[model samples]
Target: MKLTRHMMPLLVMIALLCCSLNGFAAHGEKKPEKKAILLVAFGTSDPEARKVFDRIDEQTRKAFSDVEIRWAFTSKMIRAKLAREGKVLDSPETAMARLMSDGYTHVAVLSLLSSARDMETVAGTLMKNIPGRKPEDAVIFMGHGTGHHPADAIYLAMNQVFQEIDSRAFVRTVEGNLRELDISEIPFERPTRF
Candidate 1:
């Protein structure tokens, strides 16, 4: 079956989880693996943004029918905001703790910000979805970067991939020292094109 952009990340995550479980099983432990999937995201306070998470949750549940699925938010601020509004969300640590306590031996934590391959799929999807996009029109994607983490390199790699795919495509970070394409250098005649 052909994977959609939204499902690509989930498939990659499932493959990784399967590999991990297989490796653990190879160790000769007799305990049955109680598998679970934890979907982690930076999260958002906006109701509209929350819809994306809901969709992901629904899709994950459908994909892993037998496995339990849960969610955690990485952003403390977002969590706090939601909590104040009477919606409780768990942190990654708390979620993992709960999973362990519930006897989930094999828990796969899937982050919303996926690897370069998944990001490439998302970028391509975004470009294709743009209404009446032109060959000369540029598409710039802004991503939230982990300041000091090694994962920050993914942004750089994605930027390079975006450039390689189409010189008009660009990626920038909201919080990182990573060098991005200079927006000032790109001449923008039609504001609508952006």
Candidate 2:
């Protein structure tokens, strides 16, 4: 077969394109972005409440071992709640800031607010201002999903925001919140005055 000038160039270009595509498709050729998991708990001074968050932290860590793990108490009000009753959170801020300064470049925050109200508002304010982090990428906040609370509607609303994966959003609450579908169904170990 006689090779024409145009045909010869076209064949070389096709070969190059094929090789590039195969290199991209190969596994281990490109590394997936590493992610970090942060579990945010409502600040609690109550011994029992501490246990609840501890269990939550443990479970979350186990579930996402591939991701770097971190924790934050996420709520000043909750810490105040425990303090007003003569209790103190052991390491709320330390845990939060340490995670920020540590090796993980991206941090996912999981809040323990019963209704996600505090996480969406108060916690939102601080997450925006993490000392050395970006609101859009560096820090992420996640909320525990409720399963038995009557306020399942709130969870539904939150689910809408957290659904977009590209955006820094999350949807979750304890299972009971969904199961009960009513606020009254939530069993509060310590009552809030407001």
Candidate 1, superposed: residue stretches over 4 Å from native: 1-32, 179-181, 184-193
TM-score (all chains, Cα) for each model: 0.74, 0.34
1-194: candidate 2 lDDT, tens digit per residue: 86433352354344334433444554757534345665655455557857867787787778886888765553556766766787655243355345434433344545454455643554455445556543344223344444433434566665444433223333445543433233343234444221
Overall lDDT per candidate, in order of appearance: 0.75, 0.49
Where does candidate 1 clash, by residue pair? Answer: none
lDDT for 118 in candidate 1 is 85
Consecutive 10-residue window with the lowest summed lDDT within model 1: 3-12
Displacement of residue 23 (Cα, Å) in model 1 is 17
